[model samples]
Target: SLSLSLYRAAMKGPGLFSDIGKKGRDLLEKDYNYDQKLTVSTRTASGLGLTTNAVKKGGLYVGDITTQFKYGETTIDVKVDTESKVTSTVTRAELFPCTKAMTTFKNSDLNYGKLEVQYFHDHASVTGAVTLKQPPNVDISGTLGSHGIVFGAEAGFDSVLGTFTKYNAGLSLKKSQTIVSLQLVDKGDMLRASYVHHLDGKQTSAAVGEITRK
Candidate 1:
């Protein structure tokens, strides 16, 4: 629900999550706290250079789970300003989607490659081609139990919707009660791999591990 004043103001501009059905909002709710315990461990050295030591590392986190308890599918009018080394612009109108989950979410994306900038030089002409990336059908996996262990395999498609398409597969395992996952990708001419790990339960991060020719 929104305050009357808020509703009136939002109606004046463009925004997302302005109007959605009640059923859609109710299905998405967030509930999370935490449980705790204390454990101890020790190590002893063997005959050669044996040593005994103990170690521990633990803590708690709040809002670890992200659920849709605060918004719904809607739109409003607003203004936005964005800046980057690549481009800059002030946006006035936009359509947004507010859903329980995004079609694809990237926690972190790092691109380190040749920067395409304008340079004047005595050189031959160059032709350019526009590109789109189509993700490939992939295998997905998860784990369960105390260790989060190795859950199961889930498969998905990696089509950038008909662009630079690639095939991929992934699995998740629990390491020390923490969930870590990895994805392997393959293009027709090249192969790429990535690893993902969950610090808590929802913060998914990915890293591009290796890319090699086929």
Candidate 2:
């Protein structure tokens, strides 16, 4: 009962496909940036936003500019870079109830584009993507259960090679102030486990640990 309440409180909106094991991943990998980065963002009254980010590390500078427009149930994002590469993504939500459709394009290589669709439900989520090339690669992932405890798996198929390129499965459990997760990735070639504990009620401070085996 307590877990259910906590799960409901933590769930703010529709879950994304990658949210399956995101908690553990974030606990182990987030907010540890060692590089210098700067970002400036602005939003207009007409549902348009522009953002530019630059990162400098070890005398290397990298930057990109992105623009986003939102209208009704659709959102479009475009990114431009100094390297003459342009990328765009269009997302439409509520295509049906809790379903969303997304398409991505790359100006440099049309074959690098992809189409993705996602469905999110209270107790489950599913996502599928396919590349635009003739012998496209496809990826599918699904998760089941609520935020308190969930099991998820993902697989990638290479149509040209007629083989599975990748597969991974993970499970995560969240309680009031603790999270534990286990993942088998790289087609079961590697295993990882993580634990996170909030030190305060505000969740601003936490202790996290992770272990991996290959």
Candidate 3:
């Protein structure tokens, strides 16, 4: 379930800063799901969407349901798991020209609430997030790029401990049909390099490779 957790965490923001070198990363990392979870999703013209996922565990099917609604620049999502715990998220985009904001609440725990914001420019992007609790954790990330190159870094801080919890950096180059990226992740405990090349103009076919060291 680590992959699913990571995917949910990554979905918290608008993805401006985190998307800096995402092409190569996606090419190298996505689509390796071995969990064998069965998922079905549908959307209606009324801006309502529903998704259900079921996975076999302990010879039984465990599942979750997620409902989403979109109206204008705002989106709302609500999810319920087999245990009947509810989580809700609201996202607003373009609140101030290229800015996005989101808030999430889990179950009935006030401490489980969180807020996130992101802003994007032609050559730069930034994101910030904080937990709505005493002694909360805070996160910040930024990226700068122009003319087919980008550099980005992200950090997390524990307000109560007054220490950094995480830090990572990445760089990427994108040409007409190829993308190369290098990332230092896991609080700088791992290094990775990835390359992706499109085989044709439509980008329907491609080659991808990656190397990592811990």
lDDT of 2 by residue, 1-214 (tens): 0000011212332354466456767866777678998999999999999999888879988889999999998889999986868888777766555455566677777445566655556787677777765777899988887748888899999998999999999888889999887889999999988888999999998888888899
On the 0 to 100 scale, the lDDT of residue 71 in model 3 is: 100
Candidate 1 structure quality by residue, lDDT tens digits, 1-214: 0111111112211111111111122222222213442323333342111122222225532212111211124222121112111211111221232111112122222221111111111211111112122222322222222223322222233444534343333334434423334434343334323233334545443221222345
**Tens-digit per-residue lDDT, 1-214, candidate 3:** 0000012222322335567557776766786565668999999999999999988776787889999999998899999999888888777765555455566677656445556665556677777777766677899998888887888899999998899999999888888999888999999999988888999999988898888899
With a 3 Å backbone cut-off (N, CA, C), the pairs that clash in candidate 2 are none
The ten-residue window of minimal lDDT in model 2 covers 1-10
- Global lDDT scores for all candidate models: 0.25, 0.75, 0.76
**After superposition, which runs of candidate 2 have C-alpha atoms over 4 Å from their true positions?**
1-17, 58-60, 95-97
Error of 1 at 114 (Å): 29
lDDT of 2: 0.75
Query: Which wins on TM-score, candidate 1 or candidate 2?
Result: 2
Clashing pairs in 3: none
Candidate 3 scores a C-alpha RMSD against the true structure in Å of: 5.4
